[model samples]
Target: MTERPNMETRTILRVIVCDNDIRKIVLPLKPQTVDSLLEQLEEKLGLQYKFTLQFEDPDFNNSLVNLTDIADLPDKPTLKIVSLVTTPTPSTADTEILSVASDDPCHSLRTAWPETFEIPNFPVDVEYRLRQGNLQYMRDQTYLQLSGELKHEILEKLSETIYSYKAYPNKEDFEAVAAALIKKHPCLTQPGSSKGWNGWYDSLRWKMGNYRSKLRRAGCLEVSINGGKRRGQQPQRNVKRPKRFEINFLPNFPDGEDEASMESKRKEMVEEMKKRRLNSALIAQNMNSTFALRRKELIEKEPAVKNTVERWPALFTNGQKSNVNARRTAVLHGLPLLLGEDPTDFYKTCFDCDSNEDMLDTAIGIMTVIPEDSPTVPYSLHLDATTTAIILEGTVVVDNLENVPQAMCLLFGLIYALNLEYPAALKSTFDFLQRVILSLGHKSLKPKIQSLKKSPNAVMFFHG
Candidate 1:
């Protein structure tokens, strides 16, 4: 028998030759030596100078391998070609000039350079490009420290860029501006820095917002008051102000009238009152007694009685009396009445469990076993056991019970019942309870209560 070669499969390798000139070459999986690959590169690229091949790892850490050694290349292999030639170094004066230019603020902006320096025009249109460069140059470390006129100039240039482009200073624009500022002035991002990027970004956004608002307001004013103006036309400078009118405080006064004129005026007033059907005694009675009783009835029936009282405070308070506590109690009592149950009986059955700890524990246990289909085996075993380890034993569990799921379910049951009998009270109590749960940080109870809110049993709990 003769040994066979696996010719059924082949691997293609992507090779990158990096040097003064970079090139990419692909090679097939064949039993070729390393020297053969180099020869192919030399022939293809027309290399006249001798070069050494190295793997393109960081700092060229891989050892130099023998050219005759078989190369075990992976699917994509990157190789470098280095020429054996010495390059000239810059003179000390040239190095010093380069260093100074990098530190100079005006290096990036030729227009802002010394007045004696003349910049030759390039073939490309560079006005917008130069403006962008100057905008970035404003963030340089040296420029960051400059104040007064220079700072104002930077802001003016930024405003001009935004106006020219009509770019809104949104989150993306803010991030781009902040990133450029941080890259050029890293100290602005550091803690305790007086010139932080946050304040700078906020100031720029506020200026843009104010400028946009002023333009909008001006356009609206022109449209409403002056019907706007023609394009490219200056507004009239000496526009006349509208004339002001004086109001007569005593238009119907009879101060300088004779006896006949006064008598005629009195008769005319009586005739006008009669035509309007005005009765002074009835008006006085309604204002003193009937209106007060009707307002009290409205307050009692209104669900958001708190807001009603806030709007018309005189409804609950007079100069000599305040009924704040009385109204709050009425609302509290009316909440349970909305469920078609006696308020006293409901409170006695539910909230009155505070004094009886054993009954409260039993109620909690019953709530845990609700829905009937819940896995009761483990809970039953725990309940049957007398060992302290298996049983829950603590007074704080009942006393410190905040807005948990079970309590939320009970509250939802009340709300659903109120929804059926008295929808007005249901809406008010729902909003109030939501605020209470949010303030108590019991957000986890929300989903469970919402799920229960859709249950049919919530409307009539005795049926469940």
Candidate 2:
């Protein structure tokens, strides 16, 4: 009997890698998504996967085409694969310029040739990246050393002067060069050097160094000099240098006037206060406050406690001592005794007086988590229902809350602010609050706070 021929059917698929160029890759099986393919490669090859992908026609024979551009494909997957060979197309950076270190003036001019020159007319900004990736970014000194167009411009100004060399004299040598130049041109004064070659050289050096330092700080100039010497490298030609000079351009806020400017400014102050309050509260709650007592004589006589309940009906106005939100919430929460005070007024007497600075100073001493030598001192924050709302409004800005005198001041402030409308009477409550802050040292709360502060990332509040 004759043997029967067997027939089999298979779906043909091809893998193409998107890289400097596209190349076909033999994928054992078509992956459902790119992520699965990377997982398979990582597991099989024990390599961290990172690659761009494309698909090829089932036929697999031709100049490698970009499979990613095909209209029918779904979204690209995250899988990376290696095994794909590409005919990497060299970009403009592939062009090479051979150099023979010659003292010829032409060679000097060539040194000034920027690694890149922008084509202003081009629809898009175009730059020439040098083939030598490790070439140092040339400095202004290097460019000035070259007698190029820029050099010519400098030389023209000094032609009448006896100074022949266009090079900038070193600061130590500048006076000598200026004296010699001034003798030849009676019109040229020694002070001219301040704005002439010497001055330009010094200014350029300073600016370039500043610019390059900025680039390095930002990690933009990662390409090392000569591959890894870690020495000074010039910025690639035409690359914009990073800005380094600092000048305050914005209008300065007056001292102590947390006067709400725009809504944005108000929001910022509110948020800052809330964080301080929270930190203070947490510190206060954990203290051994049983021994804590207010300095009795320091307490001022109390005024008639205003009934704030009816005050909720009043519209927010300037010069009011209470914040609108504080009063409204107090009334809503049935805390009628605390009503009628404006919360936003910040202070009825002196606006700039920091009522909480003393508390913050105490917090710095009480906070053991913070090194006594730490540059930033612990700060005390005062928050009420409105202020607490400000702190938890978005995110906690303060980082070292555990080092605070009372970490839960924020919580207490929030509770009072949220559950009761008018803040507890300021004078008596602040004294009481101080005692509460001292209570944070109580043994029961210390560990809980330590655990909170020591957590790798302890966030006081999460933003919605």
Candidate 3:
């Protein structure tokens, strides 16, 4: 048979003692004398000096009282232990006298109780008390090591406070939130090797911005727009005025008979005009010299022509019909060689193009020979130079195109290849490609064209 639990047994009480170090001790619930408790503390802690104990109030304003009985203390009471000091006293004759006996232990205890304990008659809000305690702890400890649950609770409280007051969390809101969090958990203020208030503030601001964006998306936030300019308000102009020349005119003679003086004045004005013209000419000469010097320096810095041609083959293309036609034929004929096949048919058909229409027909024919899964089809075009120009202009073709999609793809491929070879014409090529795509009314092909235009080859091309 099992023995029944005893209901009459008192629970153990816990007491925290703090001085130079912190310690906790368990005591029997049964009432004990203050002298016995002090003796047990001195013996168990191995303390050699005499000390006084005081209740550790959260407000830190509690008065120290003489301990009479251990039963008088509350459950889990916190206490501060302070070492006692004594000094000698002077007698009536001014002679120093030392007392051999120890001073009374209860002599320094205050007579009045702390205001917090004295206000038992009034009702108190628990939340208010908790906030005050947290603030007091923040003030006393440099860091408050909190558990995960406590940290979460403090963060939740801060979030709620921030949302309740404003839609957008500004610096002031973040400051308030930070202050509250620090008070609740001082460890947040000094997060060792972790993000501090500034990081937290930035995170909070981001969260607020995200929240605002969501509200705006949901049509819950209202935004105001400014109408043009206010009535009767003139728009400000930023016009630059031309410089005016100051000229001195000679005063007329009183008798109106001084032709000699008038002639001399006219001669002086002419000389002044001539001097101004000479100054202008000198300024223009200096500007022209500066420009020439800069141009020469630039030319010296330019890379060698051979290296440039090797790096950018498109720079070598003269853009003439004959040269463009020859290059396009060579590239087409080389495709079969890359595929490990005979290039006789492709070479003959590509080279036989005499007109723009003949070039388009040949280009379309080359596209048919290329396998559907060929990788080269994406990067290179089979179209000759003339065909590319015709496609860019959105001209109506006389030839009945069998595969329009393949032809369009070949056009884009040619553009890509051109950009790789001649980076100097990249912008114009893309502009032309855009116009062709739009004119073709093939919306499905637009994305492909755009993708080709945005490729790294096109992006890094030098328009210069």
Better of 1 and 2 by TM-score: 2
Candidate 1 per-residue C-alpha lDDT over 286-378 given as tens digits, one digit per residue, 9 for 90 to 100: 222222223223333444867654433323322213223322323333333343333221221112222434333321121111223332221
Tens-digit lDDT string for candidate 2 (1-464): 97543323111232222111122233445455546655654454333224444332223212122334424333332221323221111110111111222332211111111111111111121111111111222321111122254333333333212111212223433344334332332222223365444643443345434443443343421211112233674533332211222111111122222223323332333343345232221111111010001101011222223422121111121211223332222222221112222222121111123243322222111111222332221111111211221122223323344312233354455545557332333332233233322333233433434343332111211100
| Regions of model 1 farther than 4 Å from truth | 1-143, 184-196, 213-464
* After superposition, candidate 2 runs with Cα above 4 Å error: 1-30, 38-49, 55-61, 69-202, 209-464
Backbone clash pairs for candidate 1 read none
Per-residue C-alpha lDDT of model 3 across residues 219-322, encoded as one tens digit per residue:
32110011112466552232111112100011112222244543443344334334423222222212211222222222334557665444323222231012
Per-prediction TM-score to the true structure, in the order listed: 0.17, 0.18, 0.17
- Quality of model 3 by C-alpha lDDT: 0.35
Q: What is the lDDT of candidate 2?
A: 0.26
* Poorest 10 consecutive residues by lDDT, candidate 1: 87-96
State the lDDT at 79 in candidate 2: 21
